[model samples]
Target: MAKSDESTVLDSGPFYHGTKAALQIGDFLTAGFRSNYRPEIVMNHIYFTALVDGAGLAAALASGDGDEHVYIVEPTGPFENDPNVTDKKFPGNPTRSYRSQAPVKIVGEVTDWTRLTPEQRQQWRERLAALNADPNAQIIN
Candidate 1:
């Protein structure tokens, strides 16, 4: 593992680790806000971080962290509808068409897996292995 002076070591085996992994996966996707809505308005670049408690996750990630590095994914469109139509109005508006936007999907890569402490790596590996062993494992909350 190539150690970088900038990196700091954190504890392993907490629920935060899984949360971090999931958020890291989400951040890998480059789909930023695409519209000019207040929520989608550009403020700065987005990154992901994790918290041990789900409430903490909701608070820290949804609210501005010290670094302004986290984002909370929320529903911005209808839950169900025809893909061909954008905005589904009453009887549908023919002139005012709203294009359907694709949901963001992220893929994660452990760029410095070897850099992790032995214990940290082991914990992560075990967590991942357990999930793989049982696809039904409720890893995400």
Candidate 2:
């Protein structure tokens, strides 16, 4: 319901960030880490989504042995539609994904969302491995 500097209504959300990092409330999520999907490149923006399930998927797919975590996040500054999914993978922003160079403050944690089955998790890992092996696969960072 709030307007951004550009005057567009911001997507009021209980946004979430998913990862395997063990973080407590009030921690900040920032960019510059290697991409979860494409670990070769450092990310310029930290990504989050309005959908809890989407965040859950991100945590499940994250590369780590630590337990998956989905944190309720609040943007500290401006954010924009995630170009990776909005333009290249899907039209518009149905995924409700966004990215920001600014940090996201962790306000809470989500623990009730569905978790991927072991079989499903393995499938995702295999798929990501195949994509990593591809010489031309790209993520529209």
Candidate 3:
């Protein structure tokens, strides 16, 4: 059969929501995490709301207290924020979103308790232990 011009509906994924702690560990062991929709956009990186010095993390933590996992990730490529790419949330919502051209690398994770179970953590550790390991291989269930 010849290739069609239609697109296939794949599984809903690229889910960015997970226990912050688990995500941190995963980020540390793999490509750093990229900044999502932020209220501040000081750098060339596009932002949502006005600049709030040192308040972004605090606001995020205050709002997301349940999750304690923190991932220190770095961008793997340039930020792609163009007029057509900028995503606005809603009327009152001050959250703006952007997508990275390349995946990020995780540098380290900080969590009070391991989000993943022992077995799961072990599996992730093992899977991410290879020299050329796929960063997305570890999925925190």
Candidate 4:
């Protein structure tokens, strides 16, 4: 068969969003929420990851007292490579991180993602604290 003229989907992602919020299937996760990394700032974009472990790490580090969650999500509109981790922190999007201004629907949930050990979690917490303490540090928004 001849190739069609229609455009192709950008990223074939089984994308995951990690957070402490308890969300149900069909729920919409949008921007304007306080950033998990910097709670003071309302983020302009909602971030997600293709790596399950990366999502897990995010969930683990997510603020608040609720249980960690890794949600399987589908982006409702266009998304772009998250510059926060792409070329700024790591080159070439090694984290497979992305962000969207549009909502991402909660299609399902994932439970088997690796959880951080208590010690590891603490270590990560300390690292975050140090980063937060740095006056030079900034989020890409």
Candidate 1 achieves a global lDDT of 0.29
Best by TM-score: 4
The TM-score, computed over Cα atoms with residue i paired to residue i, of candidate 4 is: 0.90
The C-alpha local distance difference test score for the whole of candidate 4 amounts to 0.85
Tens digits of lDDT, candidate 2, 1-141: 222433224478989999999998999999899998988899999999999989999999988889999999999988887877775667677888888888999999999898999999899899989988998878766
Of the candidates shown, which would achieve the greatest lDDT relative to the real structure?
2
State the lDDT at 121 in candidate 1: 45
In candidate 4, what are the lDDT values of residues 2-83, reduced to their tens digit? 1111222235689999889999999999999898878999999989989988999999999889999999999888787787
Write the residue-wise lDDT of candidate 3 on 53-80 in tens digits: 1123322432234643334344444432
Instruction: Arrange candidates by lDDT, descending.
Output: 2, 4, 3, 1
On a 0 to 100 scale, what is the lDDT of residue 116 in model 4?
99
lDDT of 1 by residue, 1-141 (tens): 111122223212111111222354454323253211123343222222223232232222232234212223322222222212213223432222111133323343322221344575467556656655674543110
lDDT of 4 at 39: 90
Q: lDDT of all predictions, in order shown?
A: 0.29, 0.86, 0.31, 0.85
> How many residue pairs clash in each candidate at the backbone level?
1, 0, 15, 0
Candidate 3 Cα outliers beyond 4 Å, as residue runs: 1-21, 24-66, 81-98, 110-141
Candidate 4 pairs with clashing backbones: none
Give per-residue lDDT, candidate 4, residue 3. Answer: 17
